[model samples]
Target: MNLGRYIRRTAAHQPDAEAVVCGPVRLTYAELDDLSNRLATALRGLGLIRGDRVATLAANRAELVVTEVALYKAGLARAPINARLGATEVAHMLRESDARVLLTDAAHLETARVAAPGTAVKTVLGYDGPSELGPGYAETLDGTAAEPVEVDCAPDDAAVLHFTSGSTGKLKAAVQTYGNRLALLRKSVMSADTRIGPGCRQILAGPVTHASGMPLMGIFFAGGCAIVLPRWDAEEFLATVERERATHAFVVPTMVNTVLALPSARDHDLSSLRQLVYGAAPMSPQRIREAWELFGPVLSQGYGCGETTSGVLFLSTEDHRRAIEGEDEELLLSCGRPLAEAEVRIVDDAGAPVADGEIGEIVVRGPDVVPGYHNEPDLTAETFRDGWFHTGDLARRRSDGYVFIVDRKKDMIISGGFNIYAVEVESVLHQHPDVFEAAVVGVPDERWGEAVKAVVVPRDGAALDEAGLIEFCAERLARMKKPRSVDLVTALPHNPNGKIDRRAIRERYWAGAERRVH
Candidate 1:
């Protein structure tokens, strides 16, 4: 069945049930279905057809969810722009995706107005107000019919232009087709022990436009409720989880760290949370263990990029318990085995599989994987080859089939001819009593060609220095793999995707150099 039909079926089953709750706004399944139908009719009135592109530049709000369902009903592709991006970057994405319509809230109407002219966007609708850009979002839907749309879309028809976080360079769009979305929904609902059915209530703590919204379709398909937070505040998050009895939540490592450090973190009654799915970057095992101690064994980890439609590998709660209770400490570092029907391989440059425990490029083939980039044919050819998508991440597969991501192929440190995975060094650094966060990078060096450097953020009021951290790493890692220089900072930089910005850290030490590496 099509994605639009999934929600329609849910609405028919439980028309009066709560479908979405974003702060003061609460929408029933019937109301959500009717509103989306009106918006779809309005979009069709604007001359948009089955294959048109519509972009939403908003945060985790009701309008964003409404727009998504509307896009599906209207048979239009969605290009969700990151709300954190600047106007120029936002404009670049709109132009790249060739979006025909731009939708923004009151706060972002100015940016949308400035960006709409530089692209093929012919209409700008404000979700909150009637700005100079166009008519109000509600006004646009007022005169439209609340009837079901009948547009037919093939399984392979484009559904979403999901843009990458772009920490390294320009952002690229992964063309997520209707079939890919269906695959994602299937895996989520069928994943054992998830309990994502009627009465399931998941919290949207991060921007729903990105990874936080990946599982939303499955939740809607299962007739569950989605509670959205306007912005992430640790205290508010904990309070919401307690007050709403949130059943599931999706977060990154950074968010978890912040929530764990809050003074009142333990005060909330979080017994309602059954699963806390964490990913978007490599989380230190030390932090994961701490989380398990305070939050019970509900923590699950997902590993996938924008190209793979959110998650292809899932580290289940059972795996986390094994790590906490078993003697195999190494299992804690794995991202977990591939999901059902998904295949992952660790291959060398020649595309040959590597031996167990040997690091190699990660390639995946699955129904959920995106077709290719939006408009870049050469890049698409290079990334998607031989029926598999070549993820630039380097990883190693354990004998038990669990995959341990070593590092991004570009982020690996080549120091004096020795290969150092930054994740490995950072993992050791996290074991330190005083170190709160650490990022390792390779900087320019005259004699050794490249030197291993570390930038760190220490715990509040903790006494830590460069020499002490270096000595601590030397005890845990190889001599050459230890950081040659360590700099204590208040906080490390983060990219738009909430991952540590290692490229930004390298730029400071490698300034004036012709290239990043020797």
Candidate 2:
């Protein structure tokens, strides 16, 4: 039931194949396997046993990927820390996960050292340079042999602790068992949108710690090259795609928007791209169309979260082509059908199935689903019940089995007894000629209980007024569904994972108000 054995097998078969690339650093399959083996041996020598936690706080780099594979080989659970977390939050996660050692890089070494003292973190190892906390990364790996360590692990043993992005509330770790990870690998290899083999290369533009990292194993298992960019810049990404002849990439909607807005976005020779997979947030239909226009029909959409290990449903490249060709106009807004061996249902408050085209909470049952949240029994029991994990997203299932996400259950705004979905309004807002991006939230209102407000960022050098924007929505939607007020801003705030921060937007308008909607 070991997942590490798969990589070792691939390394044996194709030792000279390119495995990972970042900047000037490139590693063959043999080199990557040996480095991970040495690191695993070093961790074993440090008294780390099966089931012990090892945390990593580094950006997208070769070492981050190496440490994750090494942890799997050592039969240790990996607790990947978000590189953007504050010192206090870092300490909280270390204590909560009870990590034995913290593996960090030069960028985050000082913060890791500051957070290690008051937590269960006993040692700190940096990827480069001297560390005040313990030893350098190279120093720790010097004495270990470049051979695989055969550690035994059961299918149900914990393999990875995936921390939720916390866009809604406090962060929690989803305990992805070894079986769950195996299921992820199986699903990914079978997906039409993510499958890759030798001579294929994929560009990773987002932080690999979260959604962007989901397909790493599938690529490795297929003997494809993973080109890692240290940071994300629209121009740099396009240049890389042209230079490396990248065949695939995974990105969020926000990154797509940034690239589309670039003046030279269409000038690059992106003919080699076969698939552009997008997720982590709902993209407006207008933006998706723009992306399809700019990138041809190479766009696909994947829908999942940290709890599902990887995408449970994928909108294939063919699906995108169908929508673009106007065969199924409504399919443009769908997140596509559930993948193989997975069951998806839409249920109401009492767990009853809703009629087609009606909204409800999405519940999923599959081998890739996590068993529960780590160390939180009550919360786990509430979420995982009746053999299904209840996703907090609200969606509607169409007659053809396509699912359309409406909004987060908690983010829905009720104004004057009518429910308003933020995504629905934002989608319409994006269609305006002068509008670049928009976010909708519920603002406090004494008369209506809550008012729908829009924070808009207009296109550069475009003249737009609130009256005109409101009129556009009013003509397209019912009067009640239109935003009551609009606040034009230069840019919307984004969380660390690159999703729009709606909670921060709500705080600006709901301060000191005690209004609650039941």
Candidate 3:
């Protein structure tokens, strides 16, 4: 099977249609088909064969999307690095993935140039123009013919080296096979709530190298427009939707929080939005309600990670309405049920299915699930076993199949012999009108072994104190689950993917301690 053929098919049907748009750059399907074809041919000309890895390190740009399609056409695996990653991590991933080619932009040129020397990277193509690294991206593709090159790949052929640092700050790649990626495309367009068709436009608001880029293939397969943002700005995102008449958008919770904080959010002409999907992190039920009010009844929550390729569970726009406007209020806390082609089960420690409403680790077995992490056999065996990938997210499966994420397995706080989930407490803290952001972490304690501590960022101009916040949580949460102490901060730390960094908050209180846990 080959994915590139779909691009050619779409181009044949609507060659003059806009395929991608970023700032002043717009590419018609004809241009997209030609560029990807030329680039794929050029890569083959570079002596790279099937399964060879190509890495990309750049900010959000149209070229990144082209590179992904080109990699697919050539039967090559892609390893995309987030631009925010430091040089050390960049070098580590380059070596880990054994990437043969590095395509980068001027902002990250120095890092790639410096890091590629000792690794398997043979060439570095700059996005802006030629540098000492190699020729410009356009120059490389220009040297090749635009004739189509579709490499036949097996279902198990390596397609993507999906890398993530996660909470531990260690980068690892999930070996996503061709079949897994094809499953992603199938599921993306199968659901009416998320399907992108002709005359539809999607704004990729985050870094296209990761979560935001997941929809590109589905959009292309259905002949839709992908409007990529050159950079992320909350107001610009809203304005682009108004200007481009974008029908769909995918953003993380941090971006949503920023957009909701804008005083002029209501001033923008945001009526054209049909589906505003948010994932990669959780947004509290309160924020979900606020978003529904502001963005209308078009909010979807996706739950999955790199190992799962993309979202396996999606809380559709209708699910949001059922929770907010209808009687199923508890559904607001759920991440929703499994989508097509994915089998999701909440299992106990022994790898057996847990009873309904009992918390367990989520295990998924499906075409979209990556086989295992690259070069980490031990970890691979630990996470992917008995044909199911064990997601370390602790969640409870409702009888209706909705999954409620309680906490990351490692983030659960055992204080005074009672297990307290940080997310449960954070969910309560989010209910307070004055709280803008909150992170719950287990801190060292003399008697309780671990005490629940909360770090909060209050709303602008809203008066709040540690005592008041603690009292608020105590009113809603059980006494043992409520925060024993609170620290008021202007902002909570965030990892690269824009989720609140709970690990960083716990580090401050655990410094110089004998063990991480009390």
Report, for all candidates in order, the number of backbone clashes.
Answer: 0, 0, 0
Error of 3 at 433 (Å): 1.2
* lDDT-better candidate, 2 vs 3: 3
Better of 2 and 3 by TM-score: 3
Tens digits of per-residue lDDT for model 3 on 1-518? 99888999999999999999999999999999999999999889899999999999999888998999999999999999989998888999999999999999999988886788789999888899999889899888888899898999999999989888567757889998999999999999899977999889999988888888899999999999999999989999999999999999999988988899999999999899999999998789999999999999889989888899899999988888988977799999998999888999999999999999999999999999999999999999999989999999999998878999999998999999999999999999999988889999999998999999999998898899989888998999888899999999999998887888888889899998887762
By summed lDDT, the worst window of 10 consecutive residues in model 2 runs over: 509-518
Which pairs clash in the backbone of model 3?
A: none
**What lDDT score is found at residue 266 in candidate 2?**
84
> Candidate 3 versus the native: TM-score?
0.99
Q: List runs of model 2 lying over 4 Å from the truth.
A: none
Q: In candidate 2, what are the lDDT values of residues 399-505, reduced to their tens digit?
A: 98899999898889999999999899998999896888899998888888888899999999999899899999999988998999999999998988999999888
lDDT of each: 0.88, 0.87, 0.91
Q: Which one wins on lDDT?
A: 3
Position 348, candidate 3: lDDT: 93
